[model samples]
Target: MTTKLLIGLDGQSSGDRALSFAENLAKLIGTAELLVVYVIEWSPYSFQTPEENAERHKRREEEISTAMERVVTPALARLEAAGIKAQGMVRHGNVADSLDSIAAKQNASQIIVGRSTETGLSKRIFGSSTANLVMGANVPVTVVN
Candidate 1:
């Protein structure tokens, strides 16, 4: 059976590393399907009134979708160039929860994510999403540095 891989991309340098890692893993494992997911966290403080908030959210969602497309387009192209089967998904929500949900929904054989540089005091003060996902993911998570 071919393995279905779900890779969470955060639009960071580390995410590019994860993509490379996934590509290598796919090559090694053979016949793997890659699902690349990017999450955009929507902030509620971007508007004043409820109506304005809704509009702002809608605009931001579109912007985020476009940004994700821009980011993933090249990655997907690269994967295809490498003869790897892949798809792209852009979601809006908390990174950890969104990743967990996507991985579960996709029935991913493996989940790949990048390790954030936020550690020590910073990590403690503001919990790292990568760390949270590692702990909360239902499937085995492969964290790339």
Candidate 2:
């Protein structure tokens, strides 16, 4: 059976590095396939009126469309060009949780994510998605710089 690698992309240079590392690792593994995933941070706790909920749903659709178009599609094309067997996904959720869920669903053996490019008081206070995933994931997570 072909092993799968889940690559979490942030639509940034950090994501590019993760892809590059996964590409090389996949090349080494020979029969490995990749699933590239981009997660848009979203929360389910917000309370909203009917109209507000409708607008939120619309914005969610827009974000998914934009992520699939601007981030996931290009990554898939790059993998194809590199002759790697791969697919892509765009989802809205907490990044770490979403990635871990997808990893379980897909039966991926490992998850690869680049360290976040952004750093400040917010990141320090809340911790990064990578840190969260590394702490909570069932599958092994590889962090690419």
Q: Report every candidate's CA lDDT.
A: 0.85, 0.94
Residues 41-121 of candidate 2 have per-residue lDDT tens digits of: 888996779988869878888889999999999999999999999999898889999999999999999999999766898
> Over the stretch 19-124, how does candidate 1's per-residue lDDT look in tens digits?
9999999999899999988888754455487787669768877877786677777789989999999999887788888989988888888789888756688579
Q: After superposition, how far is residue 145 of candidate 2 from its true place, in Å?
A: 0.6
Looking at model 1, report the run of 10 residues with the lowest lDDT sum: 41-50
Model 1: CA > 4 A from native: 43-48, 117-122
C-alpha TM-scores of all predictions: 0.86, 0.94
Candidate 1: give the clashing pairs. Answer: none
Off by over 4 Å in 2: 47-50
The best candidate by TM-score is 2
Give the least accurate 10-residue stretch of model 2, judged by summed lDDT: 116-125
